[model samples]
Target: MTLFELTNSLKRTITESSYGQSEKHKLLQSEYVSHRELVQFYQACNPTPTLLSLIRQTKLHLPKYKTYKQTKTKEFLKMMEKLRLEAQEAEYRKLINPDPEHTTLYDTSNQEYVSPVQAHKELKNQLTTIVNVFISVGSVSYAVWYWTASSWGLRDSYRVLLTVFFGLLVLVAEVVVYMGYLNKIEEARAKESKKKEVKKVIKTYDLTLDNLTAEKL
Candidate 1:
């Protein structure tokens, strides 16, 4: 059979078989059967068989299968144990502090958790730095322009008066733009906070150690 036909036939057989109900079978169907390497291996078979029969027949011939089974079994056990411990700790925390107030916020953009105080301090420092840079650059540029204009026959007094007016205009414009930027930041933060709140509803799963032997296949 062609590779496409063979793949479809194998998938159909797997779905109908009693083994299809197994987690191992599910993993195989999802991650392994369609893989190029496995497909190539299947193609090489003189008369291709179902994956289960192929594995059962070739288990002794492929030493890597035994090694893979052992490694995956250990890894699976470790992961399950870690999950169990985390679940237990969560349960204990819930019992100890039934209605714990969450002051910490998750910054989804940065993918970090921070307390309100820390977040405020960070934002304040960032804004201060930005304002300082803008003021320094504006002051230097205005000084250069004033000096150049004065050299080109503009009166010093007139330049000084113009500087005051220009500075005020720039300041007002900056304030308007900065306020709009702050509003946008606030809106984005509110949306992210809502997303984080929704995500806080954790979904618990019933995890079990499925047979790792099929994984080796």
Candidate 2:
């Protein structure tokens, strides 16, 4: 075909395409100085239309289209949440593939489970118990000192019993604080697991949307 025929055919396709008015405005605004590059891009699908169009045609909708303020706010917040989730997924991918020096081992030929942290924790608990016994003994010694020096004799059995009870209370308080620390650790693990599940759910939704979009096109 002649050059003029080819150019006319390209213009025809561009003018007949499904680009929106705002999109056409942008394309026409940032067009090449020569006017030929602009025609080429519009005809060849060189650059995609704006993300707004794609989103509108998908399961998502725009806020302006909704009349109620509450609906608009909800839609805007949902959009932001989706964007934030996708961003976190991208960040997770970057973290998983940080550097070539720290490649992940995928081979499962020789697998052996190890729990060094759990083993260390068990040992630490045993040591903590030993320390608690020592603390209890020390408290008993203090109680005995006070009882002997402050005019309390073995004849007053109730006073000696009360002192022993207070010493046991101190040991119980220490154990309660130790148990709180373990509870905090468990809460942190649960939070991390929840985040992982949320990420997985978002990724699955994105994949389903992508497949639907492909089918539609």
Candidate 3:
């Protein structure tokens, strides 16, 4: 065939096919991108108009088309909630009977980097506990001194009993304060442990969103 005839035939074939018309609708009705993938897709896909058009004809509506939200039917919502509950129950089971051989998908920060401030904080907590113990002992000694040296024999039976009770009250107050300090220390330790156990999951950052934005020109 002649070169001119061949070129015309190719054009006709493409025109007859669904090549020019979009395969996808104006609103992306087929697939969904994960929240984790949004930043990657936004940066990479915004530059290539042909690729964006092929994927969906709604590239213009990207930044405003509710990129982060998902609206579902009642049935889907119920199913998702049920599945979430089942997954939570499975996690509880795994915690109760953790298999040593099985590898877990989640990981903790196995880093050995130590901060000086944190070390100092831990030392301070230990020193505080020691000080609290000594303070409690001193309080008990003072209570005993008040009961014995503050006229135990001279006072009536009722008066002596009342003085002994007041001394005991001082000891109890110190004990209660020490117990409260211990509880607070435990809570802080638990919080720090929890933070260390959970690894920080990250997503793509520093996206060129200006390219996706509508231009006046």
Candidate 4:
């Protein structure tokens, strides 16, 4: 299949999958396309564009996106657990101090609250853009360093060997930077999840007056 066709096919197949309400479904969005799978698929083609070039054209970052998604999923689950516990604690406190005036001590519903997640959500798009910029910056810096330093003051044989060594170093560093960037994305996602969880815990439950009156009746 053609490059675009192949890429789209992969995306369409995965995105259209009926993964139900599981976190897997959320992680399977098109943005989270896997780079390794793309590379392997393209490599199998008789004539395909360079992997990097294709990625540049498509601007799909599976690795970073996957990390971001997985982090959010993990934090979502963790936050849910914490919120559940807090909910139970609030209930326990409510039972202990049944006075209506004391309910605010545990629930804190009196003041206006802005969710940290909602407040900082705009930063997520910009953050991902910054990470994508790093891919280019890392590559260009490696090229400049490789050619300039490798060509300076060494014998031809030594220069060649140094080039290989430096080349490997650059490659390793690039990988490290990419990995670190993904981790950063993941952390950002988790932070947002935590903020949402906090909001959920604080404003989560509201006992309606009608329900209680009906129960009494």
Candidate 5:
């Protein structure tokens, strides 16, 4: 049978078989599943034929759209953790009593609140776009390469070697670009964080100075 026919038959057979939702499926969706499975069947290379079979069976159930729920959860956790730490810091600041102890002066200026989490969130949005694009393009390319390589003798030892090398090169380039984007995002977040810190310090300094001046009167 032609590869297309073979693939279709396999897909149809698996879809007709019994499959049900399970915790494992949720985990797979959250971490392991990728578009390459749709294009190249690389997921079948897994040592667990049973799991591979399930993957094929559940292909029809895979969502057409990408969801970054896991990433959002991670960001939310980070934000909450930061907020907790900031609260503790605020408590410590109050304890230290920056205003002169000799005077009954109190500086009640509100602290400037800046959230670096928003920057992280925006970065995640951009990264999600990049990831979707990469997966879509990579899957399509792999499908085309796999289909034509052998037919054109490109899958022969010498040619296959070159094919593999070129594929690896593309993979490396994609990884580098992905990492570069992440680093740029991190730098942007760092800059925003620095600004927040500077502003926070300035506010504290101004309040302290104002309080001290009032005490001399």
Candidate 6:
């Protein structure tokens, strides 16, 4: 039979039957009833949309229905508790034994992870090497120029002194600029570390009964 005809037939059977009348009154008065009782009263209604609408109108609660909703709520709470415990355990583990990979910062420019402390030290070493090279080259060039000027009878002591002074000033300026760059990196590292400490880690859980089934097919 079509769903419409089946629904009407079930309604007529319930209205005409003496037993259905008593059951219907009991179903309405009680807060909860067994799933089997509800199905029997409704003459084994398939619980399609029409039957569901009729059940809703009666304002009756089935034990199975209540249990189903309660089960979902309990599962959701359990999932949340599990996630909370996992997060706590992960944080405790990190405090006890810190991961080296976690300690390293991702360098976007270099497309690699590097330890902030190591990077700072390496940069300082490179700067020292560069400064030494510049000083050695400048001193040698100045000595050669001074010797050449003296031999050509073109030596000016004041001009030589000024050249040396300006070269020293330029070297100092370069060192100051590099130092400022290194300071910026240090500041950024500190700020990022602070952010990590305060950052909230988000976790997700699926509460839907997407894969749930009453029986295996």
Ranked by TM-score, the better of candidates 3 and 4 is: 3
Weakest lDDT window of 10 consecutive positions for candidate 5: 1-10
| Off by more than 4 A, model 3 | 1-153, 196-217
lDDT of 1: 0.57
Number of colliding residue pairs in each model? 0, 0, 0, 0, 0, 0
3 or 5, which is superior by TM-score? 5
Higher-scoring candidate on lDDT, 1 or 5: 1
- Candidate with top lDDT is 6
Quote the lDDT for 212 in model 6: 44
lDDT score, candidate 1, position 120: 98
Identify the superior model by TM-score, candidate 2 or candidate 4.
2
Error of 6 at 14 (Å): 99
lDDT (Cα, tens digit) per residue for candidate 5, span 1-217: 1112224445444334343335224323442334443333434333235555544534343335877665568888999999999999987876664533333355433332335896788688878867876675567556656766756645456555555566667677777876898799778866765663222344434468878889898
Candidate 2 lDDT over residue span 1-217, tens digit each: 1112223333344456676666555444532213353445445553337533322222221234656555468888999999999999977976864443434577332223337897898798879886976688577757765776577554456666666777677777767877888799778866764553233334434458878899899
Candidate 6 lDDT over 1-217, as tens digits, reads: 1112223434444455555456656654544445556556556544435656555534333233444444468888999999999999978966864655544465243233578997898998897869785986587558656765776655577656656776777677767877898799888877776554444559965555653442333
Model 1, 103-143: lDDT tens digits are 34642333445679989998997789678757955895598
Clashing pairs in 6: none
Q: Is candidate 4 or candidate 6 better by TM-score?
A: 6
State in Å the error of residue 13, model 3: 86
Query: Local error of candidate 4 at 100, Å?
Result: 36
Model 3: lDDT of residue 71: 79
Q: All models: lDDT?
A: 0.57, 0.57, 0.52, 0.56, 0.55, 0.60
Q: Of models 3 and 5, which has the larger lDDT?
A: 5
Candidate 4's TM-score reads: 0.24
Off by over 4 Å in 6: 1-98, 101-154, 197-217
Which has the better lDDT: candidate 3, or candidate 4?
A: 4
